[model samples]
Target: MAGDSSFDQDKNKLAEYETSSSGSYKSSRGCFNSKTGELMGRNFFSWIKLLSFFFIFCGVMSTLFGLCMGIFFQTLDYYIPKLKIEDSMIGSNPGLGYRPAGGLGFKTINGDYKGLSIYSSLIWFRHGGDGNFDRLRENLDKFLEEYEPGFFANQGASLTKCDFESKPKLTDESCEFNKEWLSDQGADIKCISAEHYGYYYGKPCILIKLNRIYDWFPDPYDINEVRNHSTMPLSLKNDIEKIYEEKCDDDPNKYCPYLNMVWLHCDGEDDPDKENLGLVSYTPFRGFPGYFFPYRNQRGYLSPVVMVQLKNPTPAVLMNLECTAWARNIRHNRLKREGLVHFELLMD
Candidate 1:
């Protein structure tokens, strides 16, 4: 009987140990599942972070390439300036207007050719009318006294009357004007058309009278936009014509022809000897880019410019002037426009 009791006790202890072991195993399994879920969540976040970094890297690379292309094209456009004479801003204004004369504006960042004098000193003059060798010398003299030593003056068309009359032949009106102007000056300034009648440098010369200079070169402070923008003289076009006719009738000996029509330039230009050429109005001024940028427009801030007006700034009336003494020859004059003569400077 004692042995049977001992066996029963042993069986009970074994059952208790088995139950405890089972519970412990269940708890361990639950803990393992929770750990696995946390690991999965962390892996998802890592994948998301990796994808975001990849996208950011691609965006940065694309921006860099775009910037590089922009710079490359901008630089290329500046150096390779393709100039078209017909589309030039300077020569675009037609027969009778105050078109901007195109020349180099020397900015004095550190050297000479600065301020108002620089602007005023830089100008080019055109030569027109039939060649009366005597009158030619007078014009040359005037140019020397008024302009820089390096100024270039080119002779356009033979000294003559209206070259572009409605019928294209030189008109009687032009002839009469030249005769009168020469008579008034007591010097010959005749103009007779040659086989060809055109601009001096593949461009047309503005053929306004000497008396009309004030209209174009007015004070910048003047609020008159018409005077500022006008290329025509200040009087009625027909009224002035009548006056000219009346003057011719009254004093036959005191008449001057009107050759005040500027030409529109185009291709097929011949460069005058640089030594003889006065100014560079061959090409037009294309502002900052391919836009019309007038210096002192009523709209925006006026761009600083150099204006050089030569009004009777001569040494003496009876002085001998060398043709090349005070003029600059650009690309054309450096090789062409090189000739010498005596001239004077006289303008009111």
Candidate 2:
């Protein structure tokens, strides 16, 4: 009987221990735990405390970064850059660029940001491809529209009527560039915007302009030196001579009208390409007038443009056309496409 009594007491103690254990386990998973975590076996209060610290830390870091950026920006001017010339990355070399542009500001690679396409360098299309030439003409018109008269007049900036002789430069002023200068008062129809920029006839027009350098001016080619140059292209030489004669020829003693021009010349890159590239023409003296330079980051500065018309590019041939800007200061590196632009032209 005593043994039976002892066994019953032991079984009761075991039952009591099991009930306490079950209650503790349920409480640990529900809202609190005593083993280690204070709540839900995951330390809910501790996680909340850590997350609050992280949030505050992120906020403080973001605030500091924004404050630093704001302070840096406060030291800058909107109109002019802090660095100039040798101190600047451009280092006085103005790169040549062309328009009738394509494949710009467009790309997709798993939807991340990247730069322009290599195909943008080529102007290629079939003769009768649907909407091809129309798109090209539209591009020209849109690009040239910025250069038209009164385009920059009401833009809250002063316009100076610049000339190579009298007004050769600007002081906080931008030149009012005229469309007449682009086509020589409608003499060059091949490059005129109304001619569809030569796209209607499958002979396209390209406009070249210098990428601006702040307060930078071209050191022009000497008139007397270029007068009887041996190595210079014939067409550019003739154009320079004509301008010099008309403007500064009469004055024998006083050399007032310097040949202040950033001259432009275009041809095929190679012999076979040149053979395929037919007669080319540049209107408005084949150069950007030096008076239009020394870009000062004026609100409405219009960099002078040189219009290049490929009158008869060979059909069904991929010809590499190169246009270079000539000046004493401009550096040329064909491999780098510096001081010049290289593009492919094709017609079919």
lDDT of 1: 0.27
Q: Give a tens-digit lDDT track for model 1, residues 1-348.
A: 999999998898546545664454336542322423423234557768988999999999999999999987776544223432245433222121111222223557776432222222122333335321222233323422322321223212322222212223232111111211211122122111221111222222221111111112211111122224343223323333453464334443432322112212111122222222233221111001001121111211111111111212222122222221010111113233322222222211
Query: What RMSD value applies to candidate 2?
Result: 8.3
Task: Report lDDT (CA) for all predictions.
Answer: 0.27, 0.75
Candidate 2: regions farther than 4 A off: 1-20, 23-37, 40-52, 103-118, 128-131, 149-153, 168-170, 184-188, 227-231, 250-258
Candidate 2, residue 265: how far the Cα is off, in Å = 0.3
Candidate 2 residue lDDT tens string, 156-247: 35677777665555478777677666664544446776776777676677888888898888888777567655656777888777776777
For model 1, the stretches where C-alpha displacement exceeds 4 angstroms are: 1-86, 89-91, 94-118, 121-139, 142-166, 169-183, 186-348
- Summed backbone clashes in each candidate are 59, 0
TM-score attained by model 2: 0.78
Question: Which ten residues in a row are the worst by lDDT in model 2?
Answer: 126-135
In terms of TM-score, the best-performing candidate is: 2
What TM-score against the true fold does each predicted structure earn?
0.18, 0.78
